[model samples]
Target: MSRSPLEKFRTIFKRSSSNSSRSNSTQSENNSLTMGGENYDYDEPPLTPLELHGYKSTTKHRLLNKELAEELRQHVPALLQISHDWELLYSIEQSGTSLQTLYDKCQPQIGESVNRRRGYLIVVQDTRKNIFGAYINEHLRPLDKKIYYGNGDCFLWKLEKGDVKDLNNKHQSIEKKEVSLNLKVFPFTSVNDFVIYSNNQFISVGSGDGKFGLWIDSNLSIGASDSVDTFGNEPLSDRKKFYILGLEIWKIC
Candidate 1:
């Protein structure tokens, strides 16, 4: 018999925890990991496995509902999809509209994070009513010497409202609007590794030939998206350029 989704979920997490335990001694040899010359101690704790249906967030979020979150979890890289609950790190409406505030508020304060590994999920809604964002492998922060962070596991995505054909009780064909959760994910193509670049002025992801796959301004009010060799993605917004109506970041903890 085929295993259920819950069974598969448990198996994946069980495998991850098992691997983490086997590698603990090897990983613990290095007491400190350096990011921009700043040493951060690794607590080196084992992975904490959650319950079976652990596809929920610790705090509520305006964008990316449970259904969408669960679906997105299914599509992420295997290591990132480990059983974990999300915690709202920052919100443009709640934390204010400044990009600097976003960077400041998104800094990970939880020292118990095993090996200092965490994932950030960003969701943005443009004035055109299109929703899009990225699954970042690292927190949003200013990099020294303008160096970029994150890796190929990071990706971009967009949400759209769509309809499909349906039939009513009378057997008449009709249009039924779906859940408005039509999601398109753009994974890394590995053409160029310009994954994430941030500074006091702006934050950009996936860059090549003077274009960014996603670029947000310092005010967090305006941005642009274009095809980049890094992710080989199309423009994410309805228009090439878009004004942000809402932005939020959720940390997988």
Candidate 2:
């Protein structure tokens, strides 16, 4: 076993201590390296005016991020409208809190609502006068003619020359359209619910031959009876046991 000389070990120990002191000095210098601090390096390149502003880099990045978020927020409504199923997408944001879980919660509604093609629900009360059904434009203004499928027959009427008098005495008549034509829901079965869509889509719901009939309103001047049948008038001959319980339309934002 070879042993180090006592003098040699003492010299090594002194060198180690010297190195430790130098390292501590370097660490202290690094600790105080901020601007205007003792260890700051003035010899380094100076920052540009924009970059010289205190916390300017960080603030600029944050502002950019906020601007991007604002832009996205502004167009979200329009984006939802462009999508095939806007309502389903809109429902996701409704719950708020935790954008991460948005997709999971919305997936089901997207599938169901899109598959059903469901939209907004307009309650056309048969008050004042029984409006078998009503149609509205993008602005939600009622069309002149209202369709009626009462007593197992289909009829059409136009809004009176002006709004009808408030018979309900609730201060306003629900909606008034002068009668145009009366046509039986021939060959189908019965009229349960009739629906109107923004794109001139009109569908009739009722219990009959296992299928529902959909008609299209070509113009406001004509009545429901005069509207062309979008779904074949005599289509689905079999008793499919189909029934139109309610009518709904989706108005995308």
Candidate 2 at 14: error in angstroms? 89
Q: Largest lDDT belongs to which candidate?
A: 1
lDDT of 1 by residue, 1-253 (tens): 9998656544433323223443556445354444443334445455444322312333232554555676678566656667566676777756778877788778767676668567788888777667788988888888768687888789998765321112111122222333445678899998888999998888998998999999999999999999998888878887888999778788774
- Please give the CA lDDT of all the candidate structures: 0.71, 0.26
Query: For candidate 1, what is the TM-score?
Result: 0.68
lDDT of 1: 0.71
Deviating ranges (above 4 Å) for candidate 1? 1-61, 161-180
Model 2 C-alpha lDDT per residue in residues 1-253, reported as the tens digit of each score: 6665654444433222223343456435433333222122222233221111112222211111111122222222222323332232211113332222322332334334433322221212122232123212212222336553323222222222223223222223232333232211232223334423222333333223432333212222112222323222432212212222212222322
CA error at residue 47 for candidate 2, angstroms? 64
Error of 2 at 62 (Å): 47
Q: How do all models score by TM-score? A: 0.68, 0.18
